[model samples]
Target: MKSPINLEVVHKVIDVFRAQYKNRDLAAKTEKILFNLAATGHRVSEQNFRAIVGHIRNHDMMSPWFIVSNVNTGYWITKDEKELSAYLDQELNRMSNQFDNVSNLHKRLRHGKTKGTGNQASLF
Candidate 1:
């Protein structure tokens, strides 16, 4: 599939993180990065930013980069062993919680505990 943002712009965003490597305090937030992109004449939305960043994190293999994002610290490139480990732990926890929620909903639906609301119909 084609990327939502241009390759050049993707590289630019990566470079922004790269420049802040190991500098946890310098992590840029999504809004700040989007603003920077807009200032540079790139028409990027928050969704586009998420899409490109998600792609880079999951698929980009040429660059040995790990983008660490946190609610408090924002986003930054990290090569530190400890920081990367923590990031992985955090992401895993988040994913686990998400899965748990989905599983709960599935169980509820299977047990017919929830009726369809409004115009929505139960798929089961």
Candidate 2:
């Protein structure tokens, strides 16, 4: 599928990091993580950023799987749908597991507290 943003520009952006610390092999991956800068002139104004995005949308060249994660630190724009799907699934599983773990711990603590503090003799 055709893409609106020239990948060369994107690669150049990556080159900035590669050049910074004299790292020879950064190994440019197939997926691109683009941090949405929006507008460089104003820190908060999203006008120019919206314009650029609008133009790209008008072109309608982006793939169906194209998405930008509004994650903290930077925006991740990836064309690799398969990779993104797997990554999201992994994150979902991890987060759910963590929540379950916390919930279980809380329940255990609460149960133990109730057992120790409750007046069992009165019930008997």
Candidate 3:
């Protein structure tokens, strides 16, 4: 049977590096990283690599994820995932509570208005 293709090579390579370099403190160049990834039988295109690098820098690395860049060496690096899901869960709950509080305050402020005022307040 043919081997299944790697869909998200960049993410997979990052995870592998995270595990492989758990103890070592080293930043790898883009070429070195690509080589290492290739050694593991994963082929990544330059466009995909550049896109993933940009993505990691932007959007805070998939929201709660983080990748550290070695400015001097131009190497992409990260130490950990940092329990992103838990962080996002807490933020989500906090935002939900804030919205609820605002909704309650709005209701209280509008309590004195007409019962039929269920829509936006008209200026006309």
Candidate 1 per-residue lDDT, tens place, 1-124, comes to 7545577877877766665444687887888878767777786878888888887888763256677789986888767789889999999999888776676566665564455652223532
Candidate 3 C-alpha lDDT tens digits along 1-124:
5333344775776575565533225656567777777788876765666666666556454333344444354343443545334444665788888776677666777777875575542310
Give TM per candidate.
Answer: 0.76, 0.32, 0.43
Go through the candidates in order and give the clash count of each: 0, 0, 0
Give the lDDT ranking, best first.
Answer: 1, 3, 2
Q: Which should have the higher lDDT, number 1 or number 2?
A: 1
Question: Candidate 3: deviation at residue 22, Å?
Answer: 5.4
Local lDDT at 31 for model 1? 87
TM-score of the candidate numbered 2? 0.32
Candidate 2 segments exceeding 4 Å error: 1-39, 42-75, 109-124
- Full-model lDDT for every candidate: 0.73, 0.40, 0.57
